[model samples]
Target chain A: MYMSVAELVDAAKKTKKPIYELVIEQEMDTSHNTREEIWDAMGRNLDIMAAAVKKGAEGEGVFSKTGLTGGEAVKIKNYRSAKKTLSGDLMMQAVQNAVSTNEVNSSMGVICATPTAGSSGTLPGVIFTLKDRLDLTRDQMIQFLFTAGGFGMVLANNAGIAGATGGCQAEVGSASAMGAAAAVELAGGTPEQSAEALAMAISNLLGLVCDPVAGLVELPCVKRNAIGVGNALISADMALAGCTNKIPADEVVAAMDKVGKGLPSTLRETGLGGLAATPTGVRMKEKIFGKAVDAKA
Target chain B: MTVNYKSVFDIIGPIMIGPSSSHTAGACAIGRAANSIFQETPTDIVVHYYESFAQTHKGHGTDYAIISGILGFEPDDSRVPYAIGLARDQGINITFIEEPEDSPINHPNTAIIELTNSKDGKKVTVAGCSIGGGTIEIRGIKMNGFDIKPKGPLPILLVPGSEVDQQNVTDQLTALTKVNEKKQYQSAKGDLFEYDLDRRLKPEEVKELAKNNTNLVYL
Candidate 1:
């Protein structure tokens, strides 16, 4: 198995194969599944992601049970339609798509966890947005997922992709890095450039904490996904333009692991610190779950 | 260090209904694992949520997810939202208890489930932890006073028939794939044997085994 980004890039360069092909071969070797079976499974994931993006973008806005988060994606779409966004149409469209996926997730709709459900929106935000801009075919879209998965596997194994384990930097941060790497590949950058994108994306969000307000995957979580998408896009662009990270991608992942482990427990999805501990956050929690839960908090 | 992630799908998928993968999808998977080990329709089930699970069970729909899993629903099943009412309709007495804040559990997202088949008075207790990314680790199982902890999250095949059937089942399973661990226990129902395999069995292989051995249980 390709356990590190350096190893993945080295193998890709040696064999003259794209990272996605190496990942597919690794999957086939470990899982004992044929290429067709693996492709079909990833195809199913793509369909799910597309359905979620469509539902979030076009369907009636959904509200979570606690009413903490909802309708933001639709609101963004409406605002984009009525006025010119400062972030430009493409970036705003990506933001809308990312927020829509997370909104669907908040309302308990089915979503393919890009790495984890909490950061599900970021990768799809990058994928679908690029699909429209690049006019990527179905197979290219599938390859994008494979490339993302390839990098994600390394990050998860070498660091992690769980907020509880390594804070939001590990969850949304890893998703962003993976998306950036995949975006680079889809943009016709080299494997080394993909690694550069991955390193830059992760290092940019290295110390980010998992501070969901009121312990819900709303508030900062939904907005962070938008930021993640933007981070992935910008990093991908930089990598494609021949920018490089001083630190190697594998070392950056290791540093992220160290930083995440060093973070206090409160900053690690415990719901007792950061925005979750803010007065307004506590009040929102009380409004939804009632006053008794405040004592526990 | 050992790599926990094995496949691309492990990183990208497990299409699921979720607000949180750890709280919702992982909890559902733990419940499903416990149900699979239980190997029978439970008349009564009591779930004990600890730590992170207790803190956010309501908002994340973890309670509903766990119930849906115990009802044999997959993580992506649309019916996960209505699981509680469905359990009630099935005449299953389900109760959820949040452990006290001071309760000492190693993992943040842990759940202990106790299930009983009221008709036959068969009982099983399973403890599992949601270890993120829509994955779970079945910590251990308690049946007839024996605590069985199979290695990690390997595929488990439980057989509860007779002492003679143990050798036959083990032989059959060993021929098909590598058996990592095997244990035997005596219960009120009969002699129960457990086999943990190094890898998952193919659907056809499971079907063939089940067809040959009526008492075979695959988890």
Candidate 2:
């Protein structure tokens, strides 16, 4: 199996196939499943993602059980409609969708975990936004998932994807890198360009810790997904514009792994550091769960 | 250590109801794995949460997730949010205990569940950890004084009963698919034969094996 971005890009180039096609071929070989079965499974995931985006962006805002996160996505949508946004419609739409998906997740709604649930919003945000802007076909959108999953596999294997294991750098950071790489491919950029996008995205989010407020996937987690989409979009555009990273994608992934490991346990989803330890955060946790429970780092 | 991500889906999806994959989906998956070994709905359960799970389970809906999974609900099942009520309706009693954060545990997200079957008065203890990305590792199982620790991520089959013919079951499984690993443990209650297979056994295959081995109480 291809273990690194270099290997994946090399195989894609040699076979004269896009990264998504190579990913599909590898999945077929490893799973021993028919191509139709694999494609149909991903199609199901796409349906879930689309449904979540629609529910979050258009439906009445859903509140989390904790009452910590809700309505922000709708607020953004209304704001973008009423006022001119500084980031333009595309970026704001992605940001809206990203926050919306995370809100849905925080409310215990069904979502396809793009690498992981905490980081699920970024990919769907980028994908659905591209669909609206690029008028991408259903198959192309599924291809976007495959391309993203391809790069995600590399990061997951080489570095990590769990917030508890490697902080938010591994969760939302990896998701952003995957989204950026997939965006490059969806825009018809070369594998090398995809790698550059992936590298740039990871480098940008390096050392981003995982400190969810109130030990819930709310607060900064939802907003961070919005930021992740913005980062991915900018990185993809830069790669498409011929920008490259001094550090390779694989090395960046390795660097993220190192940085994540070096981070204190308090910063790695323990809810004991960062914003989670803020007085308001601690008070919120007490109000929701009672003060008797000591939230250990 | 590399995870050897086998499929694109492993990275892209595990369509689930979630606030957190590790806390909710992975916790549910661990419950499902334990339920599979239990072979039936448990009448009573006591779950011990450790470290991170102890700290954040309520916010993540991990209690509901695990209960729904033990009720045979998938991670994405809509019934998950109502699992507590459903469990109560089914006359299943559940108690949750939070272990101290300083408890000596290998993983931060860990749960040790003890399941009791009212009909047979059988008790099984399962210890599992959420390693992340909606994935779980069944670290150990304790049944009738025998402890079984599985080593890898491969699909596992357990055949537990009195005087189970290990060779016959192994032969049957070998005929159906490759067995990567096998262990046989003898306890006062029965002989527990476990096999780690190359892939998950199909329902028909499981049925065929059980039909052939009368002593195979769990598969």
Candidate 3:
């Protein structure tokens, strides 16, 4: 169930008519503040377990490592990866590299969202900013979280979040779609608008892949969240504004399935395709993982 | 009536954790967040399961997620259902309302999960949407009938700037009000509760904290 590019583009073009009583909002905290909030909190939360990580590494503790907690975790989440070193934190660093560098890979930025862990950061970066204006109580925020989670849940159940299996469209595409839907709801758009936002957002990033270099979550993944948030917001608003697309949301997901299946295993988070196949990728893996896995047989 | 058709996906098991992370794990996360949000933890719950979740909820472990979430269970908890039972033992009334099947469509994964401590005469209503893969978003909330989505546009940032004429205010709020009528605009040019967050939360300080793998669930 996936919408084609031409269908989405054509429908998106109609959004310019602006029937949604459209309103856009921005809040600043840090660069890509929404995703950063999670990352920063991840960073701060690390402090709680600094002694724990050390203790685990020291053998006093076996496999126990402490981590970020609450808002602090939300804050520095993206940057928690060891930036000073060449070998960045795996999941976060992969995301950062995708957003920061121009290595020219389709594996670049994606919108992370929902239970849609693959695109988790996609909506938070966008919605939290809108949240700043809503004066939402902790309870309200929880509701917003719940609302977003529901759509993500649907995506996960219907489509797969694993890029290796379902592909990038399942991961990032779903996230962006969920993000947009949530944004529309929080923005006071009708449920119809919310659905439209989600469908539009999903159709936009259908058929992306995971395939981070070194089989790590770093690379284009980090910044992808930021861009995804932006796209989610734009497309969501477009959806809410009575802009109808020819391709339905389910069609988009199906298209993603097709694309993901067609992708080479190397491109599906195997660390064999995309940037992971590059010479720098092999070097990085050797430096970090200390293993030489070939890009191909 | 001319019906604008919308595609639908049913019984989607979110891809995050299990059992069905969005239904279970992410529900737990939101449920837990709700527990901590209230001035006091809810001793009762009025739960509404929209669409498919209502039908297959018990099997999906959604009841456990809500109960355990109220008790603040992590997504990976083996004792989640136990926690829900605990809520029952503690006299926390759990009412699950299923939306009429074949209801008008919106976000397929949305639900209205409400919590209340009837004994205390307090209530919290949460409107949430769960995405695939155990992720969640809170769309709105009604606490004692207080609406929470900022009733206006342009999230006011405390970046500190000089006064600007209407032409210079090129913010989303401005653009929204000028064109998008449906947008609720909140004038936040001067609201700075966390002014000079250096005195409050600092970047370096935040960086110092990220070392741990603590999970931060958004409000």
In the range A185-208, model 3's lDDT, one tens digit per residue, is 666676556667777787777656
lDDT, candidate 2, at A223? 92
Residue A74 C-alpha lDDT in model 1? 91
Error of 2 at B18 (Å): 2.3
TM per prediction = 0.92, 0.92, 0.40
Q: Least accurate stretch of 10 residues (summed lDDT) in model 3 chain A? A: A61-70
Ten-residue stretch with the least lDDT total in model 3 chain B: B1-10
Per-residue lDDT over A131-160 for candidate 1, one digit per residue giving the tens place of the 0 to 100 score: 999999999999999999999999988897
Judged by lDDT against the true structure, how good is candidate 1?
Answer: 0.85
Residue-level lDDT for B197 in candidate 2: 66
For B100-167, candidate 3 gives per-residue lDDT tens digits of: 54322233445666777767787877666554455455555555444444211111112122334222
Per-residue alpha-carbon lDDT of candidate 2 for residues A1-297, written as tens digits (9 for 90 to 100): 679999999998999999999999988876667799999999999999988887887756888887888888899999999999998989999999999999999988999999999999999999999999999999999999999999998898788788887899899999999999999999999999999999999999999998888789998899999989999999999999999998988899999999988988788777888999999999888898787765442
DockQ, per model, reads 0.61, 0.59, 0.04
In the order shown, the chain A TM-scores of the predictions are 0.98, 0.98, 0.60
* Interface RMSD over true interface Cα atoms for each candidate: 1.5, 2.0, 15.8
State the C-alpha lDDT per candidate.
0.85, 0.85, 0.46
